[model samples]
Target: MGFEKAVMVRNSTACAMEWSIELEKALRPKNPGRRIEAIYQIGLRLEQWSGEPEGTMVVYDMFGLVPGEDRLFANTIFLRLADAFQLGNKRDVKSRALALVLFGCWADFAKDSAQIRYLVLSSLVSSNVLEVRASLFATGCFSELADDFSSVVLEMVVNIVTSSETESVVRLAAVRAFAKMGCTFSNANRAFKVS
Candidate 1:
């Protein structure tokens, strides 16, 4: 194993690419410890500005990596980010939450094209607070695409708003998300509004 790595090191390009792919592996949360570290690192990649309204920094600005930019890898880093976000499992919760919030901020290129609708549905139902908020934020940004499942999301959001069990903060976020999705939700609202 050591000898193989030594030979690969001589090929600088391959070495760099190899390491880049290896680094992408870390983006996946293998456990709780790594998720926290990944969240911090991902946060650093996303910019923050006090000038923005309410000092908000919800979007990712391609940070240091762009989708088509030259980089050392067989696959681009953005694709790796998409995969990490797309995993949508409890172990990958933090990074997925981060990705969810960042989605539609720069480009929707990170979305897994094959399972986008499914991804949207799963995101709405996630138990994590951050995941829920992030999903709402992302859906608001991509309300156009979200039109495909706006009714489903709207129904869930309505439940959240009406449910006494839901926290006030989460209920508020749900209302805001519903408003953002109302482009589709409005036409779909007739059913719920009647009662």
Candidate 2:
């Protein structure tokens, strides 16, 4: 089904939940290509639903899936993030940013604290502009996971903000993400002081 029609039919919490069941089925194909295609389609559908509250809930549901039971999901996220970092346009960057946020949400739900921390740290040091932007969004989304990685993420954010070699836009994005996470300036100062 087309994304627009599917979204129109599944625009509520209940419908999104039902749609997720179907999505899982689609993602369960034995063929690796099929599984990857299903993930790509879901990403596209998510973009269509981005502005709706139900969309966010669907994202949550996507994260709620058990990674061990479906390793393809994790693989899809990694591939998507890699692709996003390679692209150089605003639209691709935003789409990839959202995908990384989804990945962060999944990691948070899975309690993969190390992966979340590693992703932020790696993104901060990346030379690609789009990757840095995606990293900022991913870190902000990781905070929503409310995992034990907040202090780590906050430290990375402060480092990004303070680094002179970082691009201005990337630094600004990090600052926005830091504020979104409601990090305290005093904590940032203390952390920076000790570093």
Candidate 3:
């Protein structure tokens, strides 16, 4: 069953089959509290769309009628989350992080493109600690594919680590990512020193 079918099966007035304007509002930079709430509710809906449940009941669609979950997710979900994150204010870390997690989930199951790497990698430089951490985690989720994020990931991590003013905690995470990328230490040590 596709996302549309799943939504129809649920038949909730709150979650209409059409793309709700509420979802777009939820992705915006304003209203951090409301953003998190909306993303959490969306996650519940997504679980049924993907069919991997954890300690929750799932509605079985015995007949496969709808025909396009992957395309819908790639087109609409990516737009609402990743594209929104790119356009929204970077200070809105809560929404940024939540969007990343949801976007990563969709990318995990879809036949993703390099376009997504740009979306995820852009989050690496976020001044907000939580957003950067979320981006790093999401990066890991996608790195398992043959996407080849090494240069971009390593370069960003290297810049972060080599920055004299970067927070110790964030620097540590960057170093971890740098290591995971399997790049040599000397390469990162050669940063242009933007101070």
Q: Which residue runs does candidate 1 get wrong by more than 4 Å? A: 1-23, 28-36, 39-79, 86-92, 110-117, 144-146, 149-152, 182-195
TM-score of 2: 0.51
What CA RMSD would you report for each candidate?
10.7, 9.0, 6.9
Q: In model 1, how large is the Cα lDDT of residue 82?
A: 59
- Tens-digit lDDT string for candidate 3 (1-195): 687766555432223234345677666646667767877777666655556432222332322223344344335655665566667666667877887777656656432655557767877877788888777666656654433565446567667787898888877866655555533453444333421
How does model 2 fare in lDDT? 0.56
Candidates in order, TM-scores: namely 0.57, 0.51, 0.63
Could you give me the TM-score of model 3 versus the true structure? 0.63
lDDT of each: 0.54, 0.56, 0.60
Candidate 3 C-alpha error for residue 147, in Å: 3.8
Model 1: number of backbone collisions:
0
The ten-residue window of minimal lDDT in model 3 covers 54-63
Spell out the clash pairs found in candidate 2: none
Which portions of model 2 miss their true places by more than 4 Å?
A: 1-40, 47-98, 104-113, 184-189, 192-195
Instruction: For model 1, give the 10-residue run with minimal summed lDDT.
Output: 49-58
Q: Give the per-residue lDDT of model 2 (tens digit) for 74-118.
A: 344444444433432433344444445556545544335454456
